[model samples]
Target: MSLRIFEQRYTRMVKEACGSESGFVICMLNSQGNKDLNEHIYPIGTYVNVVDFNLLDDGLLGVTVEGVRCVRITNIKTEADGLRIGDCEMTAPWEFTATKELLYPMDKKLEEIFKRYPEVNSLYETTNFDDPIWVINRWLELLPVDAEKKQEFLQENDCSKIVQYLSGLVE
Candidate 1:
């Protein structure tokens, strides 16, 4: 299915498919094509869940969705809890499938980065973070975005790039 990138209008009652109670503010997008033609304009009060996340080029984020078919988002307005898409205001809950191969290397990379940057060791260890992807995203925010360094980071399926990037930072 073809991936469609649309500006999220914001969702209400955002929860993970695993059944989380409290909602989180998240933007949802889909990788597979929407065959139903749900229209592209989103109204307010749209509920949604994040099925998958992938880092895109030029600092864009990629998300894949599973449920709540036919999302049409025209313009999005930011609100206190979520954004209002057109006038719909809907909530969409979704599920994500995580693979071991994808996660294991990310953990390994973060650990290796910590070893190199001992100064940030505590930062790495003490935090009760959700997963290695969070750490990697954080690191990406602070570290310099050198092409060679970024290439080095993207070279491996794991965190070898993290070490390479961290070492560059310390140097």
Candidate 2:
């Protein structure tokens, strides 16, 4: 949840989230230079709850955020401050059903990765491995994929597809 605010578009959004009661919306743009706000960006994003804010010695802002839920953004607009605002439609809480037994292998792989890296485990001490959604998000965060690629997984409503994708990555 430590996000480095490298882009101007994100700086204002993160700052505003620090003061807002509802938290912030983070939509992943397809391209870094994509200035077209009218273009349909990915609908899904993690509604982040800003827990801690710090101004690092390197002059970069380090934000500690927690994913509250998945949100679908619509009616996006670019503000004068370069921050994109939108109406967020929150997705209902999702958990893996018993039918998706294919997730078991992905779950095992995630457990193995965590056990092999205590540093990673310490970062996710509060995570519940029993939840498939949690496991998928953790894998997405840990994987070396770009933001847009991770956004692709987030947009998928089916947990099995995400688990399958992660399993494929590990395999």
Instruction: Name the best candidate (by lDDT).
Output: 2
Q: What is the C-alpha lDDT of each candidate?
A: 0.42, 0.74
Error of 1 at 167 (Å): 18
> What TM-score does candidate 2 reach?
0.78
lDDT of 2 at 83: 69
Q: For residues 1-171, could you state the per-residue lDDT of candidate 1 as single tens digits?
A: 112344443222222332563223223333342423423221222234455556577555455543232222344554554443333333232221344344454456666777787776644325423454455545664466744444334334456446445545544
TM, every model: 0.25, 0.78
| Candidate 1 least-lDDT 10 residues | 38-47
Candidate 1 residue 87 C-alpha distance from true site, Å = 19
Give candidate 1's TM-score: 0.25
